[model samples]
Target: MEFSSNIKKLVMLVNVTNSPTESEAAEDAHQAMLNISIPQTLKYSGVRTQSGTDIECSANETILCDLGNPFKSDQKASLIIIFETSGITLFTEQITSQLQLSTISEQTDLLPVPVTLNVKNTVLTMFSLEKQVMDTSFSGSVIGESAMNSTRDVGSPLEFVFRVQVLGEPLGDLGRLVIDFEWPFAVSNGKWLLYLTEIVIRGQSESHCVPPGKIVNYLNLTLSKEGTKRNKREVESVYPHAEASVTVLTTRKVPQFLDCWRQTALCQSFSCPLSNMSTQVEVRVRARLWNSTLLEDYAKALRVEVKGKATLRLLTDKPAIKMENHTREFTVNVDPVLGEEKPYEVPLWIIIVAAVAGILLLGIISLILWKCGFFRRASRREMYEAKSQKAEIKIQPSETERLTEEF
Candidate 1:
């Protein structure tokens, strides 16, 4: 009863990139490469496309988006565009110094190798291969690889590549960080189902170094896989989930934003801070699916909406400015047109009850008056009494009214 070579492996990868250091032997690029491994498999893992946002292009990762179906047979995964800028300093130190980065270049393979094993099937969930080079910030996945219905091959060597940027500056109080990741790889086509997850950060470690110290790697390659699929799909399952990565780009900053002046106001108000600065941000949201439910569920991992909301806090010099949550909602349905969610005041049950009570009270008062000659003729005695009451009230109503008149 022991493990065999046929055993598959599951790994979790969190690419730590572009970390700042306080010492001379802080970290280096080559040292960062040694960290990201299967641990059990020892497969060298790193991401090349994650390093330089624009250093190279036409990457090996292929995202086959079929307008409707992202995971078309031709393209098993969707395109995850990554842009991370870093300040890499080739050095080394100790501890989880700067996150170790992989030196091996990326052998871009968009199509996962298909296997026919009875192992659980695998699907593309969080699929993005990019990280900022160093201390600077960009965007990357949070979970290494989160899936719905899938499992790993148990002992498979899954190679991963992520870029690392080293910061020449000193870290103040933050140090020794772990990028928790989940490796989602399968050895069988039957085990593959849908989706992935991960979280990344620009970190500095204290354990990496070479001769003077030790080779500290700035970037890390993580391998991970969960041996389970969430749900199964059929033809008519309500609606298949889908995701469209529509990156919305703009030149406007928050605080000072573009008021809908349309044709006229579009040219009128371009204020300070926002005037000379060109800022960019990513708004990851969920959109409606357009194809098979099986495919839609897979794509929902990436079905984020495209909303345009930049910050104006950068206008002032305040160390770190808090960005006001600028969120938008859009729901795509069976109908061709997409519907956006507006801040709506839905009628609550309490309000409905209050309205009903008011209506009932008004109805009761009307009924009473109608039955009491409100519209019919009044009797002679009743008319005389009414006149007397009015006269008595006019002459001297109450002590309160008399006091008011005296005043």
Candidate 2:
């Protein structure tokens, strides 16, 4: 709807028609006015001529104007009427007022016939409408980050946290909040490197007076992967626990083959009439990592670069809230520890075979030495007997020689 000051200031174009004699035309022109019947609800301000000159006026009283002299030939004039009131019109309400030419001049036969006019139907809806606005701020980061540096082990869990805060009471209706995430690594040879697993949402209002479950009544959260909705049943089941002390959780395995970029999005909407209160919403997204990824591994650490953006929109036809997209970029240092090595051990059968071989070689060497007399020793009794026998034989031979000499 359009707004203008003319809505309060009324303008009328007046015309007079009569065929008067030369004597009447020669007479002096006189001042005139139109009797106005305005509604009692209206508080009339002063009036003005077409040239913006002030004219005395009263509430529900006469509107003094300068219509051209009726005693002369046909002529025209304009009257500017200004008024004010406190009443406001709704969608289709209107106001009406009646205006009639003064009877004093009409009784004196100044004009040929009576002139009557009415103010056109006027509606002041544009003046009553107020622009809807809300002040908000958005931010996102890795949960355990320190100076923009984060760490995640290979095949371990990673989390991303996002928050939105309202500085004042929201005059406009709340719409969906969209957060888009693009991972640093992608699918490797049709295998998933990393994918979203679960999403958690928490809220607080009234300067943190309201807790997670109570604020669930005002929130509607959803999860999406590659532009497709996920966890419909899980998200719906949380509504029954609006008053419970539970946070909203939606769990789903992001489809790996659907997209290579691992693009995921989360959306949240809210109800209205949260009066004179501050609202804060937090979102935590958890993902699983695989050993194989396209990220660069340096010095036993895989450094992955991640980026994401968050946007908040109002469910209004004409929005006055000005919000900027929340953006974040960070690096994750992943340490994939390698396994330890063990010592080699010999088998029991090999030990037994080596022992048997050594025993057999010793036995064979002893038998060969005995056969070659290297280990044999003669008896000492046999050597002494042989020496005694030799001495007896020498004495017996000398006796035989003595017998021969006696003969």
Candidate 3:
């Protein structure tokens, strides 16, 4: 079975004509006709959509639009409009618009109509948005140093002021900023206790829209000496009871890192002493940019890392003394004990004693020799007299023989 019915079509028409008459009634009629067409002209003015240039339509996206009217006239009207869509669901959605219509009056014949009307749309979603890190940089320096004792001791306390500057721009909603400072195990040669005494941070930003609310003003960091094997072994050999201590004003356990935001400068004073005779200390600083709610679960996709180093010398405080060279010239004085010529005089008693001892020794030796017949000698005068007597007797005998021969 087929059913057919005649649908009634409704059509209406009105004549629009204008004529110039020298009468007030004709002018009033012309104004009334213009007013009647204002609503129809506004209805066909069209809807203009305004949004971000980089907009990519996704779930729960906010879109802004403006409604423009093309007519220039003084007329008042109220609009109640509804939007209908198909094949999509909205969660916690709201649409708002602001409209102002001009009033039509006899005194004011023509008025400018507002061309644009502003509207806002909010769309809610269940998924979170991803953040982006724009730029990052870090720098650090050693500001000053303080020694607790006048004479450096093995476990004496030394303080150093370290300043670190962190700069970054987070394109998405900022989550957290972390700054890490790593001191080398050889900083104190494991002989001294090293720890942070105080930490102060100040934050600044190029964009005024971002405040310094998420900054962490203070952080206490305690580094482990166990990380350094060589220095710890040497320290244990010298001081068996030596152990690293936390020097921070608070007794809380030291944090390994610090969290903050934007362009920031952190100044920290560390208390470390020359536990042994270490002359230099070295420290490393690392900064990370994180976009996450918690510090440990930092977003690796939008993270930045920067590193720096600082070295402190213990002997920088001592003053150096230089020795001046000098030359000396000597001149001998001739008028005194150094130059006066005097003969070396022997003692009279000593000379006499020496001479008498020599004479006694000579006499004793002579008397002993004479007693032993060592000086006996023959008589030359007696031998000569006996020879002369023998010669005279021989002469007498020869004279007697000569006399007898003559007789």
- Note the clash tally of each candidate: 99, 0, 2
Query: For residues 253-313, what per-residue lDDT tens digits would candidate 1 score against the true structure?
Result: 2221111221111111111111211122121211111122212222222222111111122
Report the lDDT tens digits of candidate 2 across residue range 241-349: 1232323322222212212234422212222222332355665545544333422221122223233333333332333223344444333333322210111245668
lDDT of 2 at 51: 34
Q: For candidate 3, give the lDDT of residue 38.
A: 20
TM-score of every model versus the real structure: 0.16, 0.29, 0.15
Better of 1 and 2 by lDDT: 2
Candidate 1 deviant stretches above 4 angstroms: 1-147, 150-348, 364-372, 375-407
Residue 242 in model 3: lDDT: 16
lDDT string for model 3 (230-347, tens) is: 3445433322331223221212122122211211213222322222211121222222111111111211112222222232222221122111111111111111111111223456
Ranking by TM-score: 2, 1, 3
* Model 1: number of backbone collisions: 99
Candidate 1 TM-score versus the reference? 0.16
In model 3, the worst 10-residue window by lDDT is 330-339
Candidate 2 deviant stretches above 4 angstroms: 1-32, 51-71, 89-92, 103-264, 275-407
Output the TM-score of candidate 3: 0.15
- Locate the minimum summed-lDDT window of 10 residues in model 1: 132-141
